[model samples]
Target: MSSKVPLPAGTTLGKSFEYGIDVNLGTYDVPSWQPVRRISGFQPSPTPQTQDAQTYDDLGAPNSDVTGWSINHAFNAQVNRSITTGLYLPEIEAVLARTDPDAKGEYAVLDARWYHKPESGAANPKDAGRGFFTVATTRQNSGPNGEIEVLSITLTGKGPYDKITNPFAGWTVTAPSISSVSASSPGTNPAGTGKQVTITGLNLTGATAVTFKAIAASSFAVVSSTTIVAVLPSDVAGTVAVVVTTPAGVSAAVNYTRAA
Candidate 1:
């Protein structure tokens, strides 16, 4: 006898939109990754070049040998143009640059990485692929009345795609940095006992903890990805360290002075 089991309740499946492609805006040596936005119907097509491997002595069926393979990434996107500013999105601008007569070097070739972003938490390295690609863009000129214009963009691989770490690994929570901390009320000595201070730096979103002189802040609020407002706790005087912690990791300590 055999039996079958059904999937458990509340099981979540991956969505097509979870996958993303990021183009390198900077040089390959020092890459600045930015996601290609406003895209729909993304598809990756991999084709293999085959050779005849069948021999006359073969039994039932003929055999084929795979010599090489290549992949073409394609997607459709609505023309992202701002009506007020009359500016196209950065990713769209990059794609348009490729059509220029004088386009060369990096503008001609796009260094890109595509990966699946986890439903929640950090991105896994194994879910990413990186390579250089040539861009092909076709703009739709005519469609049904009142229909929005669309662009068909294809990224033809220059070489093989390589499995690599997710360039946008810490999409959820990147470790925060403290550039400078200033008390709300100036000339305040010993920044503790309900004293509010503004902490500024990069990646301050979703902060889990803020500590002053190794003592946890009484309370904290993440204003943005680059700012945090925290109430200091009681601590002994003389320059102390301030640090922020997030899901990804803890930030390097920045010195804060607390007068004795």
Candidate 2:
């Protein structure tokens, strides 16, 4: 009998802490999203409203048709107030603004999005939801002896929820790097044709371009977040610097020598 066991098709799994929420603080027209800090718990409840659809003449069990849906996003956070600056966390301030008695218009509601953090060096992160919501804040138990204050915040959905790409793509981006570069045909000199070179590094996904000795490569392709295959310019010779560019920023140059 074979000793090997079958493996699951999907290997990647996510942790609870890898998910997060962001609240928009700026105006509706020009929104700025900031991550909620000091959160201890987060729960999103989606409920469906149903109506009876079964006819008296027929079935054994009554049928219920989904008529509508609603969601409530709630979270518990540790109240963090700065004694020196006398300022609350931006996310906490957003909820406080909605609780004002005279609050009107945009101040009465908040726009928010929840997303799953992507793996490091992902070119495009996905799986996010966004919507407008009404806020409710409640103060939790206070310990007279010694305990930190906590707040429970609930956001009732106002309308439709939208599936979206990562709202804060820049948050995960890091500058690309180049650790080593090597030509595929190391002994063959470029007799008027470009040489194939492989680059290995981190955060190399979505590479816009590659440069050899300050001269652009003939062509290049990002094989993965950590590798790139490029064709060196035919005119380049001797030892030269190589660099990679991506959305986040440019990478530090690594020296490479062409075949003599």
Candidate 3:
């Protein structure tokens, strides 16, 4: 039998180069990760500031009366990526050109998340290096011998990159819940007309209507997904059932007494 030959460099290996980084703008909520072959230029250093002085025999330890010590430097994470793509350059340019007119600032920095997964990994694994970063530099390079061109990007983290867990796995949208309702103000009445009655419940956001018995409120404001403030219809009196209608569904009727 002939001996098998070794594979050449850049050959695909199982579980090799399974590293990825996700870039998110303004938020660390990344939907997915972008795979990268190689990453470099990571140096971690803790610059500590300590206050200590030489103590006489009065102190048990020679170095006594130490005021305090702390890592006085903000972490600056620098990572360089070797991306195998000619098409990625334009995308980076678009991101760098983002301008917020209202804020009057360039939204250049992007949140970056790095992660790795081996074979048989969890369906969705957690990521590393969750923090905001700015693209410090980008350069395009070519192989010495007519190989594929690589896009290089250098990212500088604004602060320390934090390890974060993924909370979106196996997540599902739940229907809103309405626990209770009450008057918004102390002087307001739960069953009084023209007063703002607050519907206290879950998923009260986007409330379409707030009705006392069968009569709709004059006006309603969705304070939050869990609360709705509605003005009771004018000239309506007597005990009535209060209910809220939303896209999810109508909540069970809660009785409200309209103060005569």
Q: Number of the top candidate by TM-score?
A: 1
Task: Tell me the deviation in Å of residue 7 in model 3.
Answer: 29
Q: What lDDT is reached at residue 83 by model 3? A: 71
Candidate 2 lDDT over 135-250, as tens digits, reads 99999867687777889999998877777776445555787889999875656643223778889999999876687765677888999999998887766458877778675556
Write the residue-wise lDDT of candidate 3 on 200-254 in tens digits: 8787776656767557778889988878878888755677766675533446557
Pairs that collide, model 1: none
Error of 3 at 32 (Å): 7.8
Task: Give the TM-score comparing model 1 with the true structure, all chains together.
Answer: 0.59
lDDT score of residue 228 within candidate 1: 94
Q: Per-residue lDDT for 1-260 in model 1, tens only?
A: 54867679756667777777877554465344556777888898877878989987787588999998777899987887878879786568777787688877766887887877766655666877888888889986576587777889998988677878765545555656789988867878546577888899998777767877657778899999999988878766678778786644456568887653
Steric overlap count per candidate: 0, 0, 4
Locate the minimum summed-lDDT window of 10 residues in model 2: 117-126
- In candidate 2, stretches whose alpha carbon ends up further than 4 angstroms from where it belongs are 1-10, 56-60, 104-106, 118-126, 168-260
Ranking, lDDT, top scorer first:
1, 2, 3
